[model samples]
Target: MNEPLCPAYSVLRLLSGKWKPAILYHLREGSLRFGDLRRSLPGVSQKMLTAQLRELEADGVVVRSVMACVPPRVDYALSSLGLALLPLLQQMDDFVQENREFFPSEEG
Candidate 1:
């Protein structure tokens, strides 16, 4: 019989995508327009970014707001839930940094 997934697994699933953690990390500073976020993450495709943002918004981890303007602008920011996750993300970053020698360098 199959057992239910653990709470940690659920959290992992919510932030599983390659770009989700980075997206959250960038948003930790403050809200950013869609174009700005896209520019910040160089390798992400527009379509992928859109999809990920939508997923995050749906998951209640990110908030998307539309501003009235000549051309309507959309901005993304971390929700309370997302903010709560920052410390965990930072801990993960700290662990990885502390064990840097175990991981392969990006230059390889």
Candidate 2:
């Protein structure tokens, strides 16, 4: 019997969540203001977004910047380490596009 298809489980151990991918996907375009990110990701509660952002920040995949202003604006963007992941993410996107039909969806 084949032991298991995915023998390596540590990778999943590092990024274990539903929203991380969405957050990363959003950062692919470049910097986004905190409110913009929240608006872009519909259905994500403030609590969840805050939690995911904090986790990504801790993982060094996202940078948080605060601009001095009357209200002190905050922004998020991919860091050097985060940019390093672009190729991998883009490759994944390409692969999915190449074989998208393998996974069907209700949405057109």
Highest TM-score scorer: 1
Q: How much RMSD separates candidate 2 from the native structure?
A: 4.5
Models, CA RMSD each: 1.9, 4.5
C-alpha lDDT score of every prediction, in listed order:
0.94, 0.81
Give lDDT: candidate 1, residue 24.
Answer: 100
Clashes of 2: 0
Per-model TM against the reference = 0.93, 0.80
Clashes of each: 0, 0
Best candidate, lDDT: 1
Worst 10 residues of 1 by lDDT: 1-10
TM-score of 1: 0.93
- How many residue pairs of model 1 clash at the backbone? 0
lDDT of 2 by residue, 36-83 (tens): 999998889989999989988988889999999989899999888778
Off by over 4 Å in 2: 1-14, 106-108
